[model samples]
Target: MTTREEVARKAGVSVAAVSYVLNNKPGVSDATRQKVLEAIRELDYKPSHAARTLKTKKTNQLTVFVNYLGDAFEAGILNHLEMESRMFGYFVNFQTYHPEREEELRHFMAGRIDGVFLLGQSLRPETLETLHKAGIPVISVMKPVEPGPVTAFVDIDWTASLQKTIRHLKSEGHLRIGLMANLSETHAHRTRTLAFRQAMKAEGLPFGETDILSGGGRLEAAKAAMLDYIRIGRLGEHTAFVAASDLMAIGMLTACRESGIAVPDRLAIAGCENVLMTLQTTPTITVLDYPRPEASVAAVRLMVEAIRGEPVASRLFDSRLLVRQSTHMGG
Candidate 1:
């Protein structure tokens, strides 16, 4: 319950100067800012967000709207986003839009946030329109559609990234490859599947229906699909397997191990999102490095630009294939 007034008195500055320093607003010198910060630390002062928002009409908060993924993956990205937002004196709020309720979307749009970042698998056109009309600057982290005037986006070039993976596999003499992906009605899954098919076709590689495995994003779902493929005796026939995410890749790897199949020697595997667990595995999975920190930084920069009424071009980052023991042979 320490107050800003106590800190201002300790620092010998006006309450307004304390406000400017704490809020990181303009019109405060660096030396005065340091004094105010020291006083705040010594006095253990915590500013009231409610009071600050009421007075300035700026919440200094941003929202990230995504589907409900598991805690581990979501926490990794959220931590990076929070760190980047802290540099600009902003806080992040995460909201999961209920799949069946449009009212939830409307409720979240009712003025608790200054800007929004869409991380959902899919965003309806009407919802986008509503957010645009509300003048809330939005930046999409993945699967962004054609944004209107007030919105921007930052994402990986998924098609090219997949193409790079395919080329690496090809160089490793992998002609027959399989793809394991989640079959949820998500824009990202669909787009990446399409990219995989297109890349396979362009390389004149024959990919049959059996080569594509689909399931939910759960480990059990992935294990079930992979085991089903194995029970049908379709596992090691393909030279390589490319999974949509590291989680799925781990499941696929587990399935292969349980089935008494050697990795890389019999079936090479690669995945996206170079998660830490992938590196700690026996074969050390090869994956595409998506640069989550860089993407988060770009998203905030674009959001701040839009907040300041400045123009920003759509931002896209490249994903590089990280080759490791999982895909290496004859070394």
Candidate 2:
């Protein structure tokens, strides 16, 4: 079958431009539209389904562009986003945002997808321009160092949250603390890392060379890294550890268990998510309850407002700390 890619090649324009012409969406000039139509005629190209959405009206469709859905935290956010989107008469879908394939984004369901929620992505300036020309608004769930064309950001106050966590750890007598975080250096994780540093600074604690560790954000890699640290006796450097996610905290617990290290006695650990597993573990994890649902609602609302051409501002929600056995001071 003749494909859209073939048609775009024949038209000598971007695949996204072809999509605009096919759906009668604005942003493609008459000259370019004519070329796309001519290419379709020559190639006998047919879209899988004719889009019923009109460019002028709300399609009630939104998509979330994310780095990965594999992480429990991200997956949980997607679940809440879908539920919350329904409350506003919108349907939601998610995609693994591949910044490497820049054109694929604008070329995807162009007419039907109204806006995008960036879970953790940095859309390059050119890619941002393409989305802008295509009339799609992009909103980040985390603040950017420089928001190129992003409509708004809906996120947590990472600095404040981390500082608060630090205070709680300090109260528990964990002055010399270390951080465990994801291996990927996305903007959100980077923000968290910076916040951790600022939090340590505010507490007058020194974060030296061995103070931070990065592994996979999920369970297995975290356990592996912890095991390596234990074997090398680096785990003794800090009385307590602050994990960026609950999964990492659990992995640390698992490592401690395997290595015959007692929790709270040998070390204390605090995590960032208050998910169920945090409680179900043998030693309940101390955590900062991530406001996933609230953030989802805020992100959806901002996208809806932006879709209507309404003025939108960035929103911030706070995470509450929940103390558990994992970070209790040993008697």
Among the numbered candidates, top TM-score falls to 1
> Candidate 2's C-alpha lDDT?
0.80
lDDT of 1 by residue, 217-283 (tens): 5566777888898899876679899987788888888888898877888889898888888888888
lDDT of 2 by residue, 160-208 (tens): 8888888888888788899887746544676677788888988899997
Query: Cα-based RMSD of the predictions, in order?
Result: 3.6, 9.4
Model 1 stretches with alpha carbons more than 4 Å out: 1-55, 69-73, 145-150, 208-210
